[model samples]
Target: MKPEDNMNIIFVGKRHEASRVLSLNGTVAFVLAVFVAALLIATAWGGYSIAVSQVEAREPSESELVAEWKRKLDEQKEELAVLQQNVQYQVDALTLRLGEIQGRLLRLDALGQRFVESGLVASDEFDFNEPAAVGGPEDSLSADSFAAPDLTRMIDELERKMQDREQQLRLLDQVSSRQKLEDELYLEGRPITWGWLSSPYGYRSDPFTGKRTWHGGVDLAGKEGSDIISVAGGVVSYADERHGYGNLVEVDHGDGLVTRYAHCKTIKVSVGDVIQKGQVLALMGSTGRSTGPHVHFEVIRNGKSENPETYIKRASR
Candidate 1:
């Protein structure tokens, strides 16, 4: 059988009846191919449209990109500004602290200078006008920069040193003052300006009695009315006449030490008068029980008499 060129269809239904004829063979195949091609084209076109929409949704627009960059840049700028402000604040705080430290240093220097001027220490040794001498080996890691914490530690250490120095200076001042007071109270020297040890202490022949007697003090002979001076700084406790010792002046040098001046023609200081070393206390003369033109000087410690010659020799040295 040959392939049919045309085919007939008849349709019968309750509502209607129809009859038609269609070409077959190659045309049918051609139509089916065309349908398949069109279906594929439509499917591919739909898939392509979906893919394009997805891509458009995923990618950022130009304005959005600019806004994002602007937002990031603004955040960075704000952070930088805050960082700068913090640094400035730290710098200001450091500056103020440094100023305070400088003031403390100045005050410390002034205190040191005052100590020097007060003669607490030798000027050349504890010289406050010049920088203190210090030395050290070069550091191998010197390249590292000092941070704020290091600076703070240095300041703290410096302040501690200042405090220690202040305490030391104060102690030195106290010691010096005590030494000066001791020096002032220590008795020494003779009572007359021009005199010789005419009569030595201890057993001696009395000039008037022509008999051996105990002498508590040395006789310093001089011209009549010669100045009789005190040998130590102290308050006068007695300045009056006595039976054996004529016009007398006695000084209390504290710490159980006392000095007595006897055979004076005139008493210059009175009781309660403060007398200094080498100050004139009376005039030498032949007064009660005795010789001429001599001042009898005596030193008493703890109510016991001590030889005045020893002190006079020490004071001369």
Candidate 2:
């Protein structure tokens, strides 16, 4: 190589008396440049390899990613299933409670209807056939939200109260029924609807014979064809013509008590017929030994005649 073609470089360092000179020809410079480029490329390749290793360590594999997603999905599904189960349980409980409440309400309505039928309360005042009148403002202090358990407890308390009320009503009904029965059986009032006492029970002068005779019953004089009602509830034992009394209607009450209404123009009742208090058993007329349109009322206790005035004056139960 020619001396002029070679390039020279000098390096001077402090504290070094000698300087170093390096000379490079065309081939050497080309070879050196190629070698430096190779070193740089090696360094870059090593750095790239390190970076790739770090990325590989940080990121997950495809299979691992799929497995992780599947696990998360399974957990979500389990949580959802649990939530659904809880909701269903609450619904079932609420449904059962509601059904019970409906049944209780129906029973209460029936009981109220009985009260109306028994005449314990006026139908217009307490109408069981219609819904009860109720109105109230929304309570601000009341809970706005209710859980399933809270609702269930409230329903239970309501049912308990309803049961207590039902029992009380039943007791009242029994008492009322007893009172009604007593009232029905009680004997009071005169046999004729419109009448005045004309003859008294005991010894009296007979109109036909003009002789003193024993009178078995009292006579109540009224208009002809007037109503002859029963003084008490009983069953008619005889409702036909008798020897002395005409068209006699004999009612046999319970407890060995009996009553007789005679001298009727028309007999309205028959034997074996049930009679109620104030029921018309016949029509007033002058039949048999009766002087005028009058009813002969007789009260008997164990087949013995008694003064009917005592029973007529007594008040009904």
Candidate 3:
């Protein structure tokens, strides 16, 4: 084919003056085609650039990868250490609380023993030497591992319960102590274990002189040589013969109270002897000015003679 490097064109109009002609060159058209082809190649190469960027993004440097793994491992180790420390602290706190609970339980057991020995109660199940008997069915919900906050809450609740129990035990101990003291000091019993109230106190005709006179005590008639015992716990202040009061025994109970036993066959206790209630002080017999085997019992309060009938009547009930 021929090159056809030159081309022409014509335009005609109805009017003779409106005619025109146009022309084109082969070199200009060739240059334009070449420029268009180069632009298409460059656009295709930009896709290759995108592919290269994707390949570079897929491969990371060895140091950068090692640094990333190290950071993650360090974070994990730190978390594990913190968890271990927290667990250890909880264990230590629980151990201390357990010790305190054990001590309080020991004290409670000792107090219970004291009450038992003092005859305050018949028996108790809170024995110190024995472990508590406890058993129950297992529950799936409670079998899970304990969380830190849950364990701490449980320990605190137990501590509060133990403190409350301690307060109650102390109150019980105080009450028991007061009861023991009352049992020891309060006097309420007859002078003789077995006897009869023969002559009342206040007034009577004297057995020796047959004259109406004031009698300071009551006369208890019983078998000869019968035991004459104290009516209350006290210290013996006197135990000797007197002018008209035969072989006499006097006891000084605390709180300005005293007791006297006269006309005894034999004096058993002496001065300074610590005596208990119902302790044998002498033996009843006819001695000095007594007519027969009898004991003259006197209740003295604050160094003055009082009616013995009131004390004797009280002991009967």
Q: Best lDDT goes to which candidate? A: 2
Candidate 3's residue-wise lDDT over 130-233, tens digit each? 77789998776846688867877887897788788778878988988777656545666667877899999987998878899999999999999889998777
Best by TM-score: 2
TM-score for predicted model 3 compared with the true structure: 0.52
lDDT of each: 0.84, 0.89, 0.83
Candidate number that wins on TM-score, 2 or 3:
2
**TM-score per candidate:** 0.49, 0.62, 0.52
Which segments of model 2 are wrong by more than 4 Å? 1-125, 138-155
Model 2 gets an lDDT of 0.89
Candidate achieving higher TM-score, 1 or 3: 3
For model 1, how does the per-residue alpha-carbon lDDT over 91-201 read when each residue is reduced to its tens digit?
898889789878877877876776676566677898777888999988888578899889878878887887887788678767766776677777776777897989899
C-alpha RMSD of each candidate structure in angstroms:
10.6, 12.1, 12.0
Q: Looking at model 3, report the run of 10 residues with the lowest lDDT sum.
A: 1-10
**Model 3 C-alpha lDDT versus the unseen true structure:** 0.83
